[model samples]
Target chain A: MTDKKMDIIRALKRAGNNPISGEELGGILGISRTMVWKYMKALGEEGYVIRSSPGSGHVLVSAPDKLYPSEIMDGLDTSIIGGDIRYFDEVDSTNDVAKKMGSSSDEGTVVIAEMQDSGRGRKGGHWMSPRGGVWMSVILKPNVVPAYAPRFTLMAGVAVAKAIRGLGVEASLKWPNDVLIGDKKVCGILTEMDAECDQINFVIIGIGINVNVLIEELSEDLRSSSTSLSEIKGEELDRIAFVQALLRALEDEYIRSKTSGFDSILEEWRSLSSTIGRDVDVVTPQRIIRGKAVGITENGTLLVETAEGLEEIVAGSCIHG
Target chain B: MTDKKMDIIRALKRAGNNPISGEELGGILGISRTMVWKYMKALGEEGYVIRSSPGSGHVLVSAPDKLYPSEIMDGLDTSIIGGDIRYFDEVDSTNDVAKKMGSSSDEGTVVIAEMQDSGRGRKGGHWMSPRGGVWMSVILKPNVVPAYAPRFTLMAGVAVAKAIRGLGVEASLKWPNDVLIGDKKVCGILTEMDAECDQINFVIIGIGINVNVLIEELSEDLRSSSTSLSEIKGEELDRIAFVQALLRALEDEYIRSKTSGFDSILEEWRSLSSTIGRDVDVVTPQRIIRGKAVGITENGTLLVETAEGLEEIVAGSCIHG
Candidate 1:
């Protein structure tokens, strides 16, 4: 839908049972009275309840609760990140779509899906993406080497954790790219990049959050290990607002990473990390290492103090003891 | 274009000036005499000089000196490297084509072009790829993190140097990915990779070698800094034999790197290196580091002992002081 329809709906909602004149809307939106009426009519056709009178131009009764581009972009304050978003009712995977578009897409382009038929996790794992999850991917073009690419996963984790904590929830960061609510995973991030030797062409960051999914919606295996925001708060969240907050936080962190450095994001990640200081088992493709998760390196490698010594683990699945 | 045709041609060339009977040729190739006659007719149509007599079947007078897939694959000893090659008469860049195919291609899939319209060098420079040059790219699916990708460039350099040295030329390796003769570059390599988080999906190693380009054909600026095999050896080398040797050496080094480790390759690289022990200027995107090139790290980073201290540079352009 057009932003004008959204603006008209928002204006009528703000009026709160009072009638708003078309002239006032035209003045507010810098459009003609006829254009305002056209927008109101469009909004009414889109299931928005509106009433009109001779003197009172329009009044809003209710609006749809769907996550439309206009709804998500209503108050998005970032200059990038979500500036150009493609919304899909259903998709195989947002990451796949974003990856296909990444080479030619502008930096900060985004793709979001209402539901995914083939959502994926790290190492070719399947992710259960129900209707209530926020499945989105963003494209970024960073001027960095492939070695420094893993740090973007940490940056995304920190951004997601900060945004979730902003809603008064105790969200913690997991090693690599996960957000946890208490001991259960609430979000997962997958970062992929295309690079030519030392220079990166583009990176696609896929973020999937269980915003309002019910516990029963998860598969039997994941039911006990996964928690949604609605399950933690005992109520469904405003998904549009949550997504806006997340995009803003991610954009801010991305800017910080590009302009300043990743140190601040790394510090924030360390503060929210749930893996540090815990005895853990990290299973890499080659072998498994048991150790205390001591710290993280600048390149986003996990520093584990094992019997062998301090080992830097680049990739693995971690199990806490 | 077919292996059968190539087999007939190879057999006839091996006979020198003698003509073998069609029955014997068919028996040697496990085909009927009519099939051998058809292949001879097709080869003659493709500018190959073949003569047939009633008693003495067919004889090859001369064949075009082209780097066709059949020619390169004829008696190729590598188990991998050149097993599945996609040959192009002309292409924009072999690296670009290989990168596009990398995700779906097999581990040792290769792309080669007779001439590149827009061949590229490292750091956004143009590579002059004439018809006689070897412009090729190989796709590798290594089980390693993206941080270890630079070592493949070193491995490729070693392979190319060893192959050229086998041809009786004193070929040396430059830091990162250049094969040089004396102070001039005779070959350049560009490595690219796709990765997700901590795991690498695929790597494209693009190798461009100046095999038989004439010295006078080079641009005025490049003439002083570039030299070809024909220029150094005073004759046009056999393009098919050179590619076979290069692919074999590359496959050997790749297997060694995977099965044993990169230490042996590193030792060979160090011995062939023209940058080691030289006072060098390493120009990274961020800054320029001036130091004595003491050694190369296992990850293919240049170990530069600067005035400040020792520094490991992951990616950059190197210049000897």
Candidate 2:
């Protein structure tokens, strides 16, 4: 059903300013002219503006600002990632939905929502996910143990950081899970998974990017620490293009993780690290380790040089000291 | 409702052979004599055999083999681990139910079912969980990264091995997550969790042990590799007592993990390990490492000494060579 709709969209997009008649579309798709008109009406209902004239036929105008599956298909590249994209107008969380689909869905399946009613952050924190933000989760079935999860987290951080940096703005990665623009966070990555001790069943890499969202949408307590792309750029940016680049970058890093042992991705993360080489306080559950971030271990753990010498922190919340 | 039932059960058990009057039970519970009679009737409905006489009161005869939450509480010794025990006659999987209860239920909440229609094993294998088997999941909210999950897996393994050895049969642990009796399998521990990259929200340790179940209950393919406690001991052991001991052992190991850096648990695992000092083929996601198992790393990773020298295998399925 959507193949024909995609054909019509592609045909219209290829024609540029020139109008393509329903008769031409029917001939191209081997369908009747009435079916072509029906597809056009469906596209119109989806907020795709179409201009129809008597002699010139129909001209494609503009598309909605929503992240519809068909709309994401416009500029989306990659073979598997986002290939089976599921879009929702609203959801409790994309990660929750992705976890449900984990057992059945193929690797790289994507779940996205325009607004999340109860989006989650790291450490049981809440993530504000109003409209105009990129609230999505990518399903990955990596063949590794739970201990190797840090590589995936670093892979996502690098991918999100690269996508944000592609917009000509300097975006750095905070160790473990946050993407920051200077001192404030513009994006966050929450990677959740279901795994046995030695093997992962599936991993849902939830990437929440505040694209074209108002800064006021965040809770008052987090307003100072969070910023959006529109707030930084002083204008709304095209979300469709940004999401395409982000998925592509993520796919690149994911391929690298499997192909090159994630060493390149780890190096990229090191180069863009906002935590390393800085005075920081890592608050682990067992104890607080205050030191200068010295380096990253081979397993993606943070090595900090404390008064007791170098200590490796496996998991913690980091605050700039 | 359950408190009253438990109080009545305790009263009957405390009486032992002496029949306590309904009047005496009511006085202890601060309820009417009629309420005490009703409680006895309820216990009778739950497969509890009771004997009533004219002058004397009700005498508890025998309790059913069912792992009711009330039954578990009788011999349970753990302060936190089994504080909230959930029991079902049947379920898809105890792990599935435990994951749902993990968010709201307190740490160490235990979920058990007599039969699982879809019991899951490690690496997407199926576990036959018919009646007369111990199918359960323990919810653990550990303050550690997913990398440290191996410790919990090892902890559950040592606890399970201890419980099985308590049955007068030697049970040893395999690297990663399997329990064995001699050369065949007796128990398996599957550790699953929901976590962000840096921290774990919850870990569900699913343990499946065959007690009174028959050896023929397993699929034909698994029959040669699997055995039951009843088959080994030539008698059906008391499950309620076994589960109490298992939960107590698990709670002890869990407390030790927090007090110690899991070095002690690792040592216990090493002592009970059937994989250590054995020539083995470790099948990992990336490649296979064939070597003699030398020792365990401090992080519970298997150290294999191959021809290339000592190798640290973080995650793998070990097969004895």
- Candidate with maximal DockQ: 2
User: Candidate 1 lDDT, tens digit per residue, A159-186?
Assistant: 9999999999999988978899998999
Task: Give the interface RMSD of each candidate.
Answer: 1.6, 2.1
Tell how far residue B303 is off in model 1, in angstroms: 3.6
User: Residue A18 in model 1: shift from native, Å?
Assistant: 12
Report, to 2 decimal places, the DockQ of model 2.
0.50
State candidate 1's TM-score: 0.82
Return the TM-score for chain B, candidate 2: 0.95
Off by over 4 Å in 1: A1-75, A87-92, A212-218, A230-238, A277-279, A285-294, A303-312, B1-65, B215-219, B286-292, B304-312
lDDT of each: 0.88, 0.87
Docking class of 1: acceptable
Q: What is the DockQ of candidate 1?
A: 0.48
Give a tens-digit lDDT track for model 1, residues B1-321: 888887888898888789899999999999998898888888888778887889877778777777778778879988878888899989999988987788778898889988999998876689989888999999999978777788889999999999999999999988988999998989999988878867788999999999998767777899998999999999999998999999999999999998989899899899999999999999987899999999998888899999999999987889988
TM-score of chain B of 1: 0.92
Best by lDDT: 1
